[model samples]
Target: MIDFYFSKDQGVKVTTVNWRIHKLAQEGVITRISRGEFTLGSGISYSPSLSNKQISLYRKLKTEFPFLSICIWDTSIINEFMLHQPGRFYNLVEVEKEGMESLFYFLKGKNMSVYLDPSPELIRRYLSDEKDPWIVKLLITESPTQEVNGINTVTLEKILVDIFCDELLFDAQQGSEMDRIFKEAFEKYAISESKMLRYASRRRKKQELEIYLNDISKYRQQPNFIANK
Candidate 1:
């Protein structure tokens, strides 16, 4: 007999181990991908970085939204800011959802954007909040009409609004982070006060709109700021 579960001081006969592996293979949980090499079946894939539970959740989400494009933000940022855990989560962005199923699917799991770059705990907390499901759904589905450096990014103004919205829904720390991002985006991207105002107007977030407008107004003396608008 060989130990199957070491902590339990339990051992399984070779026949038992073979039977279990065979049953799992039959059920498509495991497969022989190549000669002498075993692999997870169609329902599974190997991700040395993710835990079994995380992999299962990822597969389920992928199965539910086959058409959605998936991206993972830098794990270090997520660990430092969002989860505070040294790992990553799938950030699913869908551009073709026409119903509630997509939203429901995302809501069932913790989702974040490359922009949020929050810690895992924060991501989980945000997902669990009853008032934020629609907000998160909108964030996932919303796409920029353009891409920057080969990665899709929301417009600077829209990003600002997202941060402000997060602030409104959560706490000051999130809001400050959004403010920092807004400032950084303005410096790096071709953002204009008019464009920012337009985006804010479309969202009907008047207060945040006014705040951005004021920020731009104060910076009008700067040449880059003038050139941008």
Candidate 2:
């Protein structure tokens, strides 16, 4: 719209107009949704509350292995979008494959309840019995993540994709509950379809996830960004 108006009205050079657009976004006059999608308003980015336990875990792992790529978050973050809150919750610690085993054992040496990519059977038998256990998995490259108080953790895009991709881990959040979660997330946050689909592709569920998203389309309403535009 800026490009169209400026070219028709002022005949301004495209480069100068592009710079103005960048500055607008930097000054919070507009929000960038994806590569070329802009929305009006200050973006409502997701920033989960991190507990002292989560902070200590990241700090300890970083101190031990300074080069490891780690992302940590408590499952309770989902309660923000859920209508029926579950009583039990756990922590997810995703690390790069090379450091996964080493990190698991490091935490286990201190008697931390941890699991490394457990199966459905393992979930039903073991993880079900423990409260607040940490489930460590191999963090895929290019997965959407963010930093909270200097500790890495999953983004809203990754959380939505993971809920669809991992049935065993997110069983409590499945079925109609899952539908509600997706609807609430899209309504409340500035999610990038590009980032989500890229992560879904990494998990090999891009096509199936696309279908599910369409099924919930009727429940979603595009925000009225013109209020701030």
Candidate 3:
């Protein structure tokens, strides 16, 4: 939907092209579908609307660590794909490695239901039943993310990869439930397998997760999808 080179050849200034694109994006008439790629209409919506709690916490964190990368999401998003809902929910707060320790201690001191890089066993035993636990993990480099109202959250690609890789953290989403998750996600939104695989590679899940994704697509008879505008 965007043809910057063609526009430039037709005597459009680069700045003018960029400003028009920005205006369209602000109006939601077009959206950035990937890095350097914009689509003409509103694209798929992912994640539930941000709750007041989610927004407030993200703002507090941003004010304190303006330079750090962070993403936050509610566990309620998973419930849309889960058949057997767990008793408790969580707000996952993924941050850069350098900020993990400080944020963990800060949240801990405030007496929030917080855990830092919990083991699978630890999660299965204790935190699984606790209410609204805040799980902090190191954000993988190059994972795709988006910002809404200044709050950064994982992209659908990143979320699917995280569910695939972390068994302990997302235990309930395995097996048939995972199939449902993938199916529902694919049916509801646009997915970029290339983006997912690249992030999976960054997370050291390239080969295994690729096989898993391919297996999931076997019955659908679809072409390979990629991360492009």
User: lDDT for each of the candidates?
Assistant: 0.42, 0.83, 0.77
Best by TM-score: 2
Winner by TM-score between candidate 3 and candidate 1:
3
TM-score of 2: 0.84
lDDT of 2 by residue, 8-110 (tens): 7696877877897798889987777655667656657888888998899799999998998899988899999999998889898899999999999998998
By the lDDT metric, which is better: model 2 or model 3?
A: 2
Error of 3 at 78 (Å): 1.6
Best candidate, lDDT: 2
Candidate 3 per-residue lDDT over residues 1-229, each given as its tens digit: 2364554577766687778878888997766766875544555667556789889989998888899999998767877766778666778889999999998998888889899988878888989678778999898888889888778887777878888998767777888988888877776666677788899999888999879976876523222122242
Q: Which TM-score value belongs to model 1?
A: 0.40
**In model 2, what lDDT does residue 105 have?**
92
Candidate 1 residue 219 Cα shift, in angstroms, is: 3.0
Q: Which consecutive 10 residues in model 2 have the weakest lDDT in total?
A: 220-229
Q: Per-prediction TM-score, please?
A: 0.40, 0.84, 0.77
